[model samples]
Target: MMEKHVQEFAFMKCLPALTLAAAMATVGTMIPVASQADTSPHSGPAQATASTQYPVPTFEGEWAIMAMDPVKVAGNRALGPAARLLVTLPDSLQKIVGQNHFSLSRQSGSAWQGKQDDLTVTFKLVSENSAELHISGKENHKLDLPLYRNN
Candidate 1:
């Protein structure tokens, strides 16, 4: 019938729009988001354990990592579970690392080490104004870098 043909034509006209709507819905779902809740014990952000308590409080201040050097500076300052380090990495090194926070601990004297996931950063105090930071990854060997401190 003519009425049936008209209905079919209307559906055909709306076919592209319906297809586009379906595609848009799928696109929204395609973007993956990182879950805040993690099931693994060590997979989430740093937790305040008795052992992870920072022993250097004297070095507590707004510390910024500038340059690429291994510097050692730690005193007795407790880094709580919510502590996070703002890191600015080189272009080549940014791909492997995610938005993970590094937890630092004093080794001995002026030596310190920070860890985030499988990455380890060693700090050696070069001077009161300057320091050194070396980054090492699980898959990669030793990668040393220098760091300068501001206040």
Candidate 2:
């Protein structure tokens, strides 16, 4: 009777294993395999395109100096000066006038003068988004400050 009881317990365990294997086989056969050639329309390479050009601003006006700073000149003990210029462009570039204001100073023994005035201010528009101002009037010498379009 003990041998019969042991055999019955072993059979019960085997039955569960058989059922699990059958269930996995059924699931595997029901699922479909995918192919590699399925291409999506939005997955293609982006086309090459040209960027739009921005309009340039006209440089013609009476500008005042806003601020100035000293910059190190390459290989020179003296520092280069930078100024913030306010300018109003004229209808013609030939009749342009501007002002430059700088906050730059040179070393005690350095041969540099920081200055900003009417004679030192010069303005030029490089592009619609940028402009260049040259200042050379006071203790500070030449400066080139890039200006962006306010709009």
Candidate 3:
């Protein structure tokens, strides 16, 4: 029949467009599901419990400068020999690094955080005997140190 033939021809002409519309609809539905999966706790920018997950090292000892010697100077001359950090644990959390003293607040993972006056000091442990310390002063200064444990 001619009518049947015309209907078949119209369907053939619209076949590609129908297939594309179906594909677009499927993708649109999947987009929301995919976004939800990204926001889930199992993946993507989740809160780090790195402190609990990793073993935190102690911050009770002396740390000596391994690099950036001249930059740590407080006055006209370098505080040679005396140019080291002495951290007394627990109670006072007293720190004697250069002419500044910081009170320890938290020691988590490979990091140590403290306060000196209004400034914050952070120490990122490099190894069991080495760490990188950043002291917030007039200008934030960093020191890469190799610690020599005294007991």
Q: lDDT per model, in order? A: 0.55, 0.41, 0.48
Stretches of candidate 1 exceeding 4 Å from the true structure = 1-96
- Per-residue lDDT of model 2, residues 9-66, tens digit only: 9999899899999998998899876657536876643222223221111322333233
How do these models rank on lDDT, best leading? 1, 3, 2
Per-prediction TM-score? 0.39, 0.25, 0.36
How far residue 118's Cα lies from its native spot in candidate 1, in Å, is 1.6
Candidate 3: worst 10 consecutive residues by lDDT? 69-78
Q: Which 10-residue window in model 1 sums to the lowest lDDT? A: 68-77
Model 1, position 23, has a per-residue lDDT of 99
- At residue 44, candidate 1 shows an lDDT of 38
Flag the better candidate by TM-score, 1 or 3.
1
TM-score ranking from best candidate downward:
1, 3, 2
TM-score of 2: 0.25
